[model samples]
Target: MGATINLLVMASMPIAKVLLLAAIGSFLGLDHVNILGEDARHHLNKVVFYVFNPALVTSTLAKTITFESFLTLWFMPVNIFITYLLGSILGWVLIKITKAPRHLKGLIIGACSAGNLGKLPLIIVPAMCREKGSPFGDVDVCQSYGLAYASLSMALGNFYMWLYTYNIIRIFSRDVIDDANHPEVGDESFGNNTEFLLKPTEYSLMTPNNKIPMSSKFQQLLSQFSGKINLKPLFSPSTIGVLVGFMIGLIPPLRKLLIGNDAPLHVIQDSAYMLGDATIPTITLILGANLLLGLKGSQIQFRIVIGIVATRYILLPLLGILIIRGAIRGGILKCDPLFQFILLLQYAVPPAMNISTMTELFGNGQSEYSVILLWTYGLAAVALTLWSTIFLWLVAS
Candidate 1:
């Protein structure tokens, strides 16, 4: 009973911490767009994307990795793929069963499968690892696994978000075209070859009278490259700092040249580590702010929230477990039980952060994505707390 209570408290502590941090950020007027300023948010993201994030990845991966450790990480991606596939199918079925419009299907699936691994787990997992003292003990290993997990989570989430956005855009464009071509609309002569394409940069750009404007060449080029732009790449101070740290960590020759063999390069490493630590906190604060912004008179239907939560928390995890277990039993996957559990936990996480961004880009179901994200994270925090407590108690016993 004592162990159970301790574990319960331990589990609840992290959730409380997250809630407190979010509350503090809220009270500080971070949620108010006018006060925080958009430029600061952009700069924060730029730091995370170009400098701190990639350095965190390379340093972590380089230090913690063995052949076996690298091999074990494959389980995460497999389970993520399985969960995504099953969640997509289940979301589609739900859409059809409810007789909902087809355009909503992409949003539903995207929300269910995106798994906010970066934002939430940054708080949850380290605490759990510290308590359990599992594979995360060696600072190198912890960094490596964290980076690998982040890379996988972000890449998969980004890919799916893009895919769903594309589908939503296609659906919306089809409707617009249908409307324009309708006989009762009385404007069937809107030009035969003209088309409406939604680009990530410009949202929707319309080509009218079946002619591309020569003056808009620069705009068209910008649209083509906007999604590919990784701003603040070469000269960003944070990027340079992290890269220098990563080089020191990974390359023995560089380490010898820079810091020498006497010392362990703790100063540089610690500085980079401190910056790395800031990445997650900054991300969580941004997410909290985004959620608050989204909640302003946003009419998110409760039914949609319920559906998204059910799909994300229940269906995806179930499907992931079954698929992974079946694969293991069939000798298709050679990963150990610990790796399998990690994969399962990854699937169990809530919607990704990028879903809201994608919804805005596609101009379809942004509100639904925002509502689902807030509710899903709130529910996920509760579920994780309860589940971790139970697991810890079982282990202790």
Candidate 2:
């Protein structure tokens, strides 16, 4: 009982910090306060998105990652994918059960599928490791590796969130826009538009009179290939930051030059670190301000909110335990206990804060998503504390 209480206290500290920051944000965003009002939040979000996030990704990954660490943490990507698959299935079910509106269905799925693999774990793991009586030995060593694991998790989470959940929200929300614009046509017009986007130029290998030349056919094939692939998401600022970080971290010469105190160019990395430090607080503040909209009474359904909270907190964590433990039993995951714990923690986090940004970008479900986030994150302190305690006990034992 003493051990459990100790673990619970350790777990709750990071969550408490997050809530405190968000509380300040919420307070500032109030009509009477207005420091973090809608306009202020919008501008701050731009700064965080364009500046802070990329800097954080680049500095953290460059500092923590190396060729060896990459090999050791190979299975993490697979584990994250499994969480997305399971959560997505649950999200789909919730959408159907609630009969969520077209605009909100994507938000629902986005919330379920994209866990907050970035900020929360980055905050929680290192903080827990520093606490008294941490299950992982030697505070310094534990915190160092824990930060690395969390950084890599953030990088990969950004990759998946942008490519997968971003597109889902974009497509669904666009459909809603199309329907509104052309109420009589419905999906047919949208389908045609999508087809047009995918295959803008029709390719012909044959004509009524003669078969097309191989050279022309090659060009046609190239067009089709390029048309189907949307690489815009791949080049997002955060994604580019990840790629740059990987380049610096994986190559010993580059890593040594940029990352270490002895290196001549270490100032670059230090600058990045300074900028990156603002990411968590700025994001948390924006989240709090967004929640103000939810408090103002949005059209979101109670059942949808409850369903997402249950799926994310209850069903996902239990399934994550089974998957992580089963992998250990089967000898597929032979990493250190801290790494295992991070994998488990990934499943147990709140939805990605990026989901709200996506909805805002697409002009759909901004208020609804804010409401969903408010409930999930409001309850997150308890949920994460409970699951973190269980995960700590499981891994430590």
Candidate 3:
């Protein structure tokens, strides 16, 4: 019992820090302040995405992940996929039950499906490792391995969130979304791209049948091939980090150069690590700013919010416990409590904030997404703390 109390405090402190930072972000985003207001927040998001996050991803992966760990944790990608699959099913049910608008169906499903796997765990896991009475033995060992797990989760989450959930939102948003103000629709060659791909080759210019060039055909084939396998996410920085880091950690020469004290180019790795350190705070602040928008006004129903909350916070965690424990019992998962703890944490987080941007990209139900995010995150302060405490107790025992 005493240990549980300590675990709660250990878990809660980092979350409290995140909440505090988020509140500050909200304050900065207020109309009166305008520091992290809409435009500024967008710019900051760009920085985090293209710069800070990638650096963090690469550094963490390179520093902690190894070929053995990668092989052992193979189920992570599958686990992430299950979260999306289950949430999507639940979201679809919600849409049908609530009679939600067709335009908002994808957004609803997306909100249910994608968890904020990156930011919170990055914050939570590291913070938990820092506590006085932590379960994970050896502070440095705990931090390193904990980060490896979190980084993998973040990479997988980012890949899945954009590819699967983003497409779901994009596909459903197309019919009802307004073309006039919809950013992607404004492109002159929007529908023409697909038309060009499928159109038969013209005989000749004189016959007024334009001959499609071989290059064009190949390009279309390439595009179709890429889309079929969802290749875009594979190239995302997080995935790249995983791939490159895996190589470095596995290969002797590269690993020696970037890791440990005596390496010649350790400075470069250190530089990246320093830059990567900025990721958590930046992500939290953006989360706060986005939540501010959600709080101000939303047409979303309370029941919808409750449904997502219930799905993410309660239902998914139960599923994780079963799946993970079963995997362990069946000898598929290692019994490392920290690794187990990280896997459990993956299931219990809020919806990915990137889903909000996705709705905006499709020009559908961005406001509704904001409202959903607000409630989930607001409740996560309590949900994450309690769940983390219970999870630690279970894993440690």
Candidate 4:
């Protein structure tokens, strides 16, 4: 009982710190306060996206990751993919059960599928490592490894979220907007290039030379696939940071040049670290300001809210435990206990705050997405604390 309380306290402190900072941001965003108002938050978010995030990702990953370390942590990407896949399936089920509105369906699915992989873990892991009696081990070593795991997690999480969740919401939201504004003239315009590729077979059959070459058919299929999927988000700044960091860390000569105190060009890494330090606070502040919109409330259904919460907090975590433990039992995952803990933790986090950004970008469901973020993040402190405790105990055992 005493050990359990100790772990719980350790877990809750990081969450408490996050809530406290967010409280300040929320206060600042208030109409009376007017410090981190909408405009301020928007600019700050861009800074984080373009500057702080890349700096943090590059500095942390460069300092810790190497070719060997990268190989050892390979399961993490697979773990993140599993979480997204399972969560997306559950989101689809929820939409069906609730009969969610067209615009909100994508929002709901994106929420379910994308966890706050970067920010929360970045804060929680290092904080947990610093706590006395941490199950992982010595504080310094634990902090170093934990931060690396978290940084890599953040980079990859953003990659998947942007490519998968962003496109999902963009498609659905744009469709809803188009249907509303133009009922009669949908995708019937001549410029709809996707139409020709989609009906290539129909077009080919009509031709006198009825045998379309295999190469032509392959190119047509490729075009159709590319047309449906947006790949631009896959190379986001954070992801590029990860790639750059990997390059520096993996090569022995480059690693010696940039990473250590003795290196001549170490100033660059130090500068990046200094800039990266601002990422957490800046992101949390933006989060608080954005969440303020939730306070205004939306017409979103109560059942939908409950469904998303239950999926994230209850169903997903249970499945995570099973998958991770089964992996260990089957001898598939052989790495640091902290690495496994990070993977399990990935399954338990709340929805990505970026979903709100997407809803705003798509120009619909902004208020609705904000409301969902509010409830989930409001409960995240409790949810994360409990799961962290369980994960620590499981990994320690």
Candidate 5:
């Protein structure tokens, strides 16, 4: 009983921190205050994405990642990808059952697919580690390693979230706004030459062309796939930071120059660390600001909202436990409890904030996305605390 109470109390403190920051954000976003308004939050998000996040990921990865860490944590990226995959499958089912609108299909799928892997975990892990009853032992050591995990989570999360969710929303918008709902759009209207990628079957499906050779047609399909993915996301600053961090960590001479005591360029790491420190508060505030938009008056469907919450909070977390435990039983993961705890927490957090940005960019379901974020974040206080307790107790036991 005493231990249970201690763990619950430990869990509650971090919940309070997140809630308090979110409240402050909501207040700032009010029309009267207009301090952290939508435009303001959008710009703040850009700063977090382009500046603070990369700095944090680069610095943390440099300081904590080693060749051994890579080998031990190989399951993470795959695990995160699986989380997205499962959420997508769940979302598709929800959409079918709910009879959702065409424009909103991608939004539902994206919301369920991308957890708030980066921002929430970064704050939650360190705060949990810092608690008195913390199972991870040694505050400084726990925080150092925890931050590294969170940073890499953020980096990889950005990669998947942007590449997959962003495009999903964009494609759905084209379907609803231009293709079916609006009017048949000419392929020439698409400025980026991306329209052809969307309807790869329009040529073949609409008209069977026997004159096309199999190998030559296969080459055309390959080029279209390549064009759609584009190299831009792979070369995003955050992704680049991960690559650079890995290079610095893996190479001895580079590590000697920038990392550890007695290093020549140690000051550069300090600069990045200082900048990265600003990421959490700013993101949490932006999250709150965005949710405020949803709470006041939202136009989204009730079933859509409920579907997302169920998929993210209940289904994905359950799936996370099974996958991580199997990895453990299969000897795929190390016997580090803290590491296991981090992996489980990935499935339990709120939807990624970038989903909101993507909705706004595509001019489809932005308000609905905000509403989904509102409730998910509102419930995160309770849901995350419960999951954290279970995860902590499970690993500790």
Candidate 6:
């Protein structure tokens, strides 16, 4: 009971610290719009993506990972997959029941499945790890493990984004094409690209009939070939950073150069570690700013807010506890306190803020996403507080 109470107290500390810092920043107007400037935000994101994040991942994974540890961490993937699947299904069912537009269904599910990985794990997991007494038995290991998780989560998020975006585009485009090809369709103007081409447009318009001219076919082919190749994904700074870091971690010769007491690259690694340390606080502050700027009480629909909040905070956590308990009873997984806590932390996490950002990017239902985000966070804060208190009491008793 004492151990449980200690665990609960430790778990609550990080979340409280993050929220407090964010709230203070928001209240002080330090995080107000235009305070940091868009260019600064972009540059900071780039720095995090390309330098700090990868460095942190490489450093942590190299230090902590081995064949045995690798086997244990397998649970991370399973937990992520299950949560995503469950969230997606729930979102889809809700959309269907609401009879929302077909186009919105995908967006809704994607938003629900996407989580605030950056802030949640960085802030919450490390504390949880420390509480559970990781193999390293050092608080710093929490930060290191958090970084590794962050890298994996980021990679997964990017992959999901690409898949989801492609599906959305294909669905919408197929629908448009089908509408155009229907003989009974009275709207001749619906798919008329020639008319659109004749008129100057703000956005680039593409139509199925706009084939390349025969004379310019080779030139057009080359142009299309060049345009079709998006090297950005492959060669982007972030990709390069992650690749380099991953390689270094996997290769003992390179790994030796980056870490350890006698390492030549220790200084570089240390600097990166320091910078990586800043990521969590910055993310939390940004989240607070976003909430302060956009999430007004009046904008929320209480019933919808309650439903979404309950799904994340109540249903998910309870389900996760049950799953963990069942896994233990069945001997599917060894009963490790750390693993149990991790599963709990995953369930306790709030909705990903990135979802709302993505919804706005796709020009979908931003308002609904915003409401969902606001409620998710709000509910998570409350639920985590209550859960932590209860968990602490149970452990201490």
TM-score of each: 0.69, 0.87, 0.86, 0.91, 0.90, 0.71
lDDT of 1: 0.57
Q: How many backbone clashes does candidate 5 have?
A: 0
Q: List model 3 lDDT by residue over 1-397, tens digit each.
A: 7777788898899889999999999888888998998899999999888777878877888887777777888888888888889888888888778877666777888888899898899989988888898999999999888877887788889888878887777655653443445555443323444543353542231224655577765676676545444436447777777787777778889999989879999998899888888998998888888898786667877788888899999988888889988989999988899988988888899999888777777677878888888889999999999889888888888
Candidate 2 differs from the real structure by a C-alpha RMSD in angstroms, to one decimal, of: 4.3
The count of residue-pair clashes in candidate 4 stands at 0
In model 2, the runs with Cα more than 4 Å from the true position are 181-230
Q: Which lDDT value does model 1 have at 375?
A: 77
Q: Candidate 3 clashing pairs? A: none
Ranking by lDDT: 4, 5, 2, 3, 6, 1
Candidate 4, 1-397: lDDT as tens digits? 9999988998899999999989989999999999998888888888999999999989988998877888898898999999999999999999999988877888989989899998988888988888888888988888877887888999999999989998888777766666668575454322254333346354753346656566766777676556657888889999999999898988889889998899989999999999999998888877887788988999999899999999999999999999999998999998467898899999999999888888878888888878898999999989999999999889888
* Candidate 1 positional error at 284, Å: 1.0
Per-model CA lDDT versus the true structure: 0.57, 0.83, 0.81, 0.87, 0.83, 0.57
Which has the greatest TM-score? Answer: 4
Candidate 1's TM-score reads 0.69
Better of 4 and 6 by lDDT: 4
Give a tens-digit lDDT track for model 1, residues 1-397. 7666667787777677777776555544353434434556556666776766655544444344445555555655556666667767777677666655545666666666566655565566555555543433555545456554554455444444455434444444344455656545432222232233333444334366645565565566565345433332234343343344445545666555434335556465455556666776777666665665555535555676778778877776666667766777798776443344455566677777766655665576676666676677668678767655554443333
Best by lDDT: 4
Mark the 10 consecutive residues where model 4 has the least summed lDDT: 188-197
Candidate 1 ranges beyond 4 A from true positions: 1-6, 29-43, 132-152, 159-272, 325-338, 389-397
Q: Write the per-residue lDDT of candidate 6 for residues 1-397, one digit (tens) a residue.
A: 7655555566577678777876754654343545544455546556666666665555556555544656766666577677677767776676656655554555556655555544576676675556553332456755565556655555544444444432443344344454556545433322344333222441224345765455454554455445433333434343445556666666778778876778998887777667667766776666665565445444334554555566667777677677766777888766554445555556656676655544555555566656666666756666876665553333233
- Which tens-of-lDDT digit does each residue in 1-397 have in candidate 2? 8888888888888788878888999999999999998889888988987898889888877787788777878898898899889989999999889988767888899899899997888778878888888878899888767876787788789888877888778778776776777676545413444323334344344556756576766776576445434557756777788888889999889988998899989999999989988887888777777777766668988999999999999999999999999999999887477999999999999999888888878888888887888889889989998999899889888
| Pick by TM-score: 1 or 4, better one | 4
